[model samples]
Target: MKRSNIRIIGVPEQQEEEQGLENLFEEIISENFPEVGKKKVTQAQRVPKKMNPQRPTPRHIILTMANVQDKERILKAARERWKVTYKGSPIRLSNDFSTETHLTRKQWMEIYKVMQSKGLNPRILYPARLSLKIEGEIRRFTDKKRLREFISTKPAMQERLKGLV
Candidate 1:
């Protein structure tokens, strides 16, 4: 008997085999799952939506007198008890009722004390003044007219205002 020698052939190149496997896998995925590819394509092509900026709105304010007093006492107290300062210099009260500036807190306190000592109510010594300034988001309601209206309309509010008075 004679012995025979045989040579074995190598499989196809690994790179080519790998590429073929990848192509087969992609074809299988596309055929079996079309929605996945569509979703990926749609997501890739989407653009974000634009948003609009907001504008701030203007607010309304109301004010009214908070107290009433006899004009004579206010004048007298302003003349005799209060001191007005302007530009670091003391202002003098003339007979014509002209002064460089308004009275100070200390002056107002002195006038109040004088009025209290004379057996007169402090509220009756000055005129009522109202001031409004927009601070922020908070709404501060200090309208005397609205307060009076509320007091007139609501018995509870009327009782509360009377207690304050």
Candidate 2:
């Protein structure tokens, strides 16, 4: 599958009429990521999702970047910073993956959270590697079988999984 150029989420929707999305993108990049050039942005749009009318929140901002290096830089910066806030709310920025990959990563979300709650900072790497930081060292599991093997080594993880696994 082809890698997506760019996607940014959790950026607050500014309710200014004169300041369009393009302008907002420029503003965000300038404010949070000065190293990234706004001119590299090829396409930017809001990803639609179901909203609550009584308490509507910001829709995700997705973009296509012309420069792959710039995109990687932004993503890396965002990850290092953890949460980028706008209007007192947190925002997320990430790479846009193909549907299959996205769904595949999503399926193991419960395990991800379980590992996190156990003081393991686990992350799913591109093309699907389950990486976790444990005891000041980073360990990665290449596939589900390897991940399962690693988890089986941890009785705590097994106890927590119960039926979830």
Candidate 3:
């Protein structure tokens, strides 16, 4: 499924000011995404991420963006900048997807990048499948194992994947 907004997750929980979640959200957006600024945000907040304390998953911040361009810019910056921080604490930005979609995207991360670098347009099908145009042919993979097997057989894919991985 397509997401209208991106999330700022893995931000260490912050003490709420008088404005609470809204203030925190604005602070992050203003600092990390100066181009978009606080005015463009439709909504923002911290949400619970259900994970074990043993693992210590940080609380997630959700941002309801004004448009896709703004969202994409923020996500791209987050990806390239790596571990953006606020008040000395590291934060992560991601698409605000359902848990299933998030897991699927994570699983296919490598292949997706490889496909893009190979000059193929790789599109993720909802619920976690990848479809791409490679060598003028459309190829789709619903499973990671099958995708890996396919990559192993193709020398070019194997070489590119090797350099990337």
List TM-scores for all candidates, in order. 0.16, 0.63, 0.56
lDDT of 1 by residue, 1-165 (tens): 111111111112232244542342233224433333411111101112234357222111111111222222222443554553322333332221113212322334543454356443433121222221212322222334543554477585355335332
Return the top candidate by lDDT.
3
User: Model 3: runs farther than 4 Å from truth?
Assistant: 49-51, 103-140, 144-165
User: How close to the true structure is residue 135 of candidate 1, measured as C-alpha lDDT?
Assistant: 28
* Per-residue accuracy of model 3 over 137-156 as CA lDDT, tens digit each: 98889987787788888998
lDDT of 2 by residue, 73-143 (tens): 87887787776765566667778887787787887677788777776678987776788775577888766
lDDT of 3 at 40: 69
Worst 10 residues of 1 by lDDT: 38-47
The model with the greatest TM-score is: 2
TM-score of candidate 1 against the unseen true structure: 0.16
After superposing candidate 1 on the true structure, give the runs of residues whose Cα lies further than 4 Å from its correct spot.
1-142, 163-165
Cα RMSD (angstroms) for every candidate in the order listed: 39.7, 4.4, 7.6
Give me the runs in candidate 2 sitting further than 4 Å from their true place. 1-4, 14-17, 52-56, 76-91, 113-127, 131-139, 148-164
